[model samples]
Target: MTKITLNAEARSDLGKGASRRLRRNANLVPAVVYGGDKAPQSISLLAKDFAKALENEATFSSVISLTIDGKAEDVVIKALQRHPAKSFVLHADFVRVVAGQKMTTSVPLHFINAENSVGVKQQGGEVSHVISEVEVSCEAKDLPEFIEVDLSNVEVGQILHLSDLKLPKGVQLVALAHGNNLAVANIHASRAE
Candidate 1:
């Protein structure tokens, strides 16, 4: 598990005006920490620090230690609002993580052996990643950085679904539990003529 830690300051100044001032003058991103048994807390993180933490894809799925006002809390990235064109994070939302509690969050999917898969190696097929991520429910300790999809034996025209995935112990696919077996990826026959 990749451990990530973020240092933040509790934000007393709230609302659009204060947020704008923080971003313009202090280069901070306003965020909220909610969930668990406590009331929501308003906080602000340095824009560069936030961006740097975000540089790691695992930061989204792994448990992050957010220290606010000298106290540390475990949280997961919930929602992020970004500048439409600039693509920089504007506002962020995070949900507190409890040790024994289960949380629902999306984790990136890694397609392994795609180039070596029988379909691509001998059948002239290409791997099509229909989905890049999947939502899962698990404890903070069981949360995975990524789920691997092995395509070594997949044949051409074979479609892999959510239920087809081999999940780690304690990790459950939200869609599969709800009876929605979504298509994950597939090996499509090459169209090259």
Candidate 2:
């Protein structure tokens, strides 16, 4: 898995007014880190630096190395609040990762060779994705950035469910024992009709 580096500073003040002032004057993003049996700490990061780190989708879904006041820690982005109109991040949440402990997280699913699929090309069918991400359980070190789904030979009307996917070592899908359908690819009639 890839890691993203971020520099953060301890924040003393709290509440909406303080956060607004911090953003308006200092261009800082108010964030909090909680997890791993440690007390939650309020922190702030430069808006530009935080935006730059978020440009990579992997950073949102993968483990990251955050440097807070010169101390480095392994963490993952748990949640983010965004301004509804401008779509700017209002606040962010970080969860500290503990080594050797199993954690559940959502990982993106990447489709491979969809255009070359027989069902899509020769059969005049479209590939539909039911789920873009899947929840999986694994150790922090064994977490994957994304899971790949192959659609080379998928035929029309074929549905690929969660149970059909092959998970990597140390990773297991978090779902009911009966296994709900997590459609990776589905062949639908083309729109030309």
Candidate 3:
């Protein structure tokens, strides 16, 4: 996983009015960094810079190195608020990360060789992905940007479940035993004309 560097400034003001003012004048993004033993600190970041950092899909789950007033901190994005009409970021929540501690995050899934799968090519079947991402628990450094699912030999009517995934080293899926049925992909038979 790669780290995104963002510079933030501590904001002492609170409330909707102050946030709106910041957005109107400076084009700043109101955000909060919480978690760990420290109290959540309210901060503001440049809207353009923050938007650039968020351009990557992995930004939501990947570890970020935040530089606040020259001090660097390891954190992960926990939540985001975007404008309903324009889709611009309105607020963001970040969680502080501690080394050696396990973190839970949803990692994106990428399918490979789906077009070449025997089920689709030979059996006239269609591949349907049930889950586009899965929640995983692991050390921040062990987090994978995306999990690849292979469909080379999947046959029609076969369903790929969470247990069938081959996770990276040190990564573990977070789920109850019964939840393992969460299907990742399925091959459906196609109708003949």
Candidate 4:
């Protein structure tokens, strides 16, 4: 898994107005880090830096080391609020990650060999992704950046479910724990249009 380090500062000021000032005047993004049995911390980060990090696909699932006032905490992006009309970040929520403890988080799914899949290439079918991401539980150290779904052998009218995914050795899908075998992807005949 890819690890990211984000530099932040402990913010003493609170309230929506303070957050607005941080974003408008200081050009920083306000965020909170909670969970992992530790007290929540309010912090601010460089908006540009946070935006740059958000550009990386791996940032969502990857563990981020947040450095605040010389102290570092391991965290993952729990939620992010963006501006309504613009592409600017409004606020962010991060969850602390404790080592040796299992945590659930969503990871992107990568469909490989789709172009060469039997359903698409041989049968002239189209591949449709029912879900782009899946939630999984695993120790912080065993967390995977993304899950890979191979469609090379999938035939037309075939549907691949969550159980079909090949997860890392130490990882388990959250959906399976509750007996939900969600559809991940499928290949079917293209429309007549």
Candidate 5:
């Protein structure tokens, strides 16, 4: 709930050709907002503003206040298509945040105390991150900025799965709930000569 807001305008032009023209002519990014009880709406946002808003990593998981033509609504970023060779975003997809409803979004994982962990500091082990982010299901209010994985207690040859990390209240890992039990990080013996 970081009061981040992006100003947007409804776009009537549809299809791939129109989207290309919009990007080339006006430097606007085409986006769509779907989900909840309302029908999907096509919109356009300023390229610079869109890029600026996404500069913060938390913006991807936190609830965003999207202002469209003076009207405001809460949303969560679902997907983003970036240019293959460029750093700019080409298209964006968002899901409308409905009160009392669960929304699934990806949040970054923060590994703490890796350098001073039992594996690295005491056992000459190196940490390997298998995944950097995880998809979670929770209400907008329960959405976490990032999940923290503590490596201080970990030992060499230990692979911490998604369920090993402590999640916040009202937050649940989507993969864990489905029995995926993905490995988030691990500590292994150093291969350096």
Candidate 6:
């Protein structure tokens, strides 16, 4: 996995005005780092650099090395707020990650061999995805950016449940932990007009 690093500065100014100034004057995005054992710290990240890093889909799930005031902290993006109409990032929230400690995060799912699935190819069925991502709990070291679901053997009228997912070592699906075996995807026969 590729590691991502973001440089930021600790901010003393707080409130909507200060944040507005940072964004309008400095083109910076306000963010906060919370979790672990330390108090939450307010910081500002460069909007240009942050936008570049966000271009990669895996960045959200991967561990990010955040350097604030020359001190580096391992963190993950817990939440992000963006402008509803504009393509601008307004605020970001990060959660500190401690090694060997378990954390829950959503990981993207990739369905492979769907086009060649028995249901679609032989049975003239349509492939449908019920969920594109799943929440998983695991230590930082065991975290996976995405999960793969093989659909080559799936047949028409068959639904793949959460239990059918093959999780990586040391990783557990959050839904399965609570006994929620939700359907992830399925193949259905097309209706004739």
Q: What is the per-residue lDDT of model 3 for residues 81-156, given as tens digits with 9 covering 90 to 100? A: 9999999999999999989998887889999989999899998899999989888898988988899999998999
lDDT of each candidate versus the true structure:
0.95, 0.88, 0.90, 0.95, 0.93, 0.96
lDDT by residue (1-193, candidate 6, tens digit) is: 6699999999999999999999999999999999999999999999999999999989989999999999999999999999999978999999999988999999999999999999999999999999999999999999898999999999999999999998899999999999999999999999998
Candidate 6 similarity to native, TM-score? 0.98
Compute each candidate's TM-score over C-alphas. 0.98, 0.95, 0.94, 0.98, 0.97, 0.98
- What local lDDT does model 1 show for residue 160? 89
Query: Model 2 over residues 58-119: C-alpha lDDT tens digits?
Result: 88678889899999988889899988998778899999999999888888899887899989
Q: Which 10 consecutive residues of model 3 have the lowest summed lDDT?
A: 174-183
Cα lDDT of candidate 3 equals 0.90
lDDT of 5 by residue, 1-193 (tens): 5778999999999999999998999999999999999999999999999899889998998889999889998998989999999978999998999999888899999999999999999999999999999999998899999999999999999999988999999999999888899999999999987
lDDT of candidate 4 at residue 78, scale 0 to 100: 95
Clashes of 1: 0
Task: List clashing residue pairs in candidate 4.
Answer: none
**Top lDDT prediction, candidate number:** 6
Residue 189's lDDT within candidate 3 is: 96
How far out, in Å, is residue 44 in model 5? 0.4
Quote the positional error of residue 151 for candidate 4 in Å: 0.3
- lDDT for residue 137 in candidate 3, whole number 0-100: 90
lDDT, model 2, position 40: 98
